[model samples]
Target: MKTLHDLHRPLGATGLMVSPLGLGTVKLGRDQGVKYPSGFTIPDDRDAANLLALAQELGINLIDTAPAYGHSEERLGKLLRGQRDNWIIVSKVGEEFESGQSRHDFSPQHTRFSVERSLKLLGTDCIDLVLVHSDGQDVEILKDTGVYETLDALKREGAIRAFGLSGKTVEGGLLALDKGDCAMVTYNLNEQSERQVIDHAATLGKAILIKKALASGHVCLDSGVDPVQASFELVFGHPGVASAIIGTINPLHLSHNVRVAVSVIQSRR
Candidate 1:
């Protein structure tokens, strides 16, 4: 049986090795304004801790969180107190969620502040990776805003090891890699519009982390096919993909995802 740890790969030239699947924690903090197929309750500390332990048992080492994920950073800070060194923490800047709403601030100052806050909230001296939480204005945010520049400075200062954009556009992903180390783009069975970004990343030796790999749990595949298996096959089949961030607080689902992901990855070899 292959564990996810067996399939860990380099995240571009960032010097950070990550598993093929990362745990996304949006459901750990916020339950509003989400686009999931069904509603879910936020897991309490015990449940969340169990899920984290299960992830480790299944060999996941990358965790994805953001300030826009309500109190996710703080919760993980407490939950992962002694095990910080075991995982690669991937966070974001420029988007904030409060009072059931979200807002964007990509200014240099806010970017700096967000990174500092994320550090504090995550209880880490240095975040392994920090991506710009873009607000659909991907091109403008990268070109007009100094957000990437600020993140580059933070990386140099050792506050963050790598930086890039969790962008919504192909242009933004390419530009982000041109300026940074990674780009988290949407790539799955339903949407291959960002395929160009993945190809470009492969060519340039940069990282491409995938989001919405399961279509936010609304996967609509053919009747006979297993959605989860198909999703992992499509994601890991691409050589450029570093990891797919899947958000699920359910232990069974997490285990299943890791199993399918490992099967796909190992078969490719």
Candidate 2:
């Protein structure tokens, strides 16, 4: 089977090389009412760091994080420091936070604070990619607020290398594609609802990274092997997908994922 390590793909014409599969930090620092992997009772800072380092060594260049996911940005920053030149960091803004919980808010001030906070937590002068976590279905985008303006300002200042949107729905993804430079979406073998959005995002010459490519572990069930390998191949096979962010606490599993992607690439070749 192929793993991500062998598949050297460009990051949506950004000129950065990334594997088809990336290590997602969502579970490492997030326990926000969402079901997490077993034995992940709390933030294992050491384990998280080790896995992150391994991912980089295995050729996974992109690490996706968000402020909404607990201390995800902080821990990822800690692990990638000094080695920052070795990885591509992507963070999200526009999410409202309160009392260990968060909600999406596109207020201009909120956007500014989110970018600053992400920078502080990430411990970096510039993040490779910044995604605006959608406040809702693309409805709020219709409003004339400083959200887009704020993002443009950050880009102009070089605080962020590029900007995109982490959409919540198919409509949100399409709206983001129409209005933003990059579009973070969820599309897997089992679901094709976002197919049009993915295609359009490709046509826009914007970067399109796939999330939930394994259907958030749903595709792993009923299959004896790790679904990530299969999932990575599936998404990478699509024309618009540039990369797929995936989660794994086990270093061996991570390596297996890379191997699976490599095999897939070799098969196609």
Candidate 3:
């Protein structure tokens, strides 16, 4: 099997190269209201550092986190300090989690504040990519909020490299691609409703990142099939997909996932 070091590709028109599998940090920080099938203990700072180190050693260069993902940004800031150039950090604004519930804020004031807060929490001068964390009301948020415009201004100010939306609906994803640099959508074996978003991203020369590619660990695989291998086959087969974000705190699982991703990509050749 190939390694993540050999599986790099461009992330659409963003001019950023990323591995086919991006390490997601949801599990690294948040556990209160996640959708994982089984309960998991959150890893401490040492474990987190080890996992991140293993990710880099395996050649995974993209790290996805969000303000809503508990203290993920803060943890990553501390863990990855002095090595920011080695990875592309993707984060989001407009969604805040507190007391185990999520809230949306798309106002220009909130957007600006969120970006600034992310910079502080991540201890970075500029965020690589920032996405609007949409509530289910995707179109309404795009139409009514100044969040996208705020992100555009931030990009001009050199605070963010690229911006997009982590949309929940097809219309929202399409609109995000129309106005931004990328779209993060959920696409897995059991649920392919967002395939159109991927197709559109490809056509528009924009980026698309896959979330919940393993169905949030709820996928019911066939007895003989490997879930990780099958999931990568479906996700990486799509030319539009730049990377599939897999959130696992376990180093063993991360290693397995990267290996499976490499095998899938190699098989395509």
Among all candidates shown, the one with the greatest lDDT:
1
User: Per-residue lDDT of 1-269 in model 3, one digit per residue for the tens?
Assistant: 34789779998898999988899999878999998899999899999999999999999999999999998999999999999999999999999999999988999999999999999999999999999998878888878888889999999999999999998899999999999999999999899998999999999999999999999898887799998888888998899999999999988888899888887898898
Kindly list the per-residue Cα lDDT of model 1 for residues 135-228, writing each as its tens digit. Answer: 9899999999899899999999999999999999999999999989999999888899999999999999999999999999988977999999
What tens digits encode model 2's per-residue C-alpha lDDT throughout 1-269? 33355566766656677767777887777665655445455447787777877787777888888888787888777777788887888888877545766677777788888888899988899888888877665546524656777887888998887777887677777776666677888788788787888888778776788877777766754658556656766776777888888877778878877777777667777
Question: Which residue runs of candidate 1 sit more than 4 Å off their true CA positions?
Answer: none
TM-score of each: 0.98, 0.89, 0.98
- Itemize residue pairs with steric clashes in candidate 3: none
Q: After superposition, how far is residue 82 of candidate 2 from its true place, in Å?
A: 0.8
- List candidate 3 segments past 4 Å from native: none
TM-score of 3: 0.98
TM-score of 2: 0.89
**Candidate 3 worst ten-residue window by lDDT:** 1-10
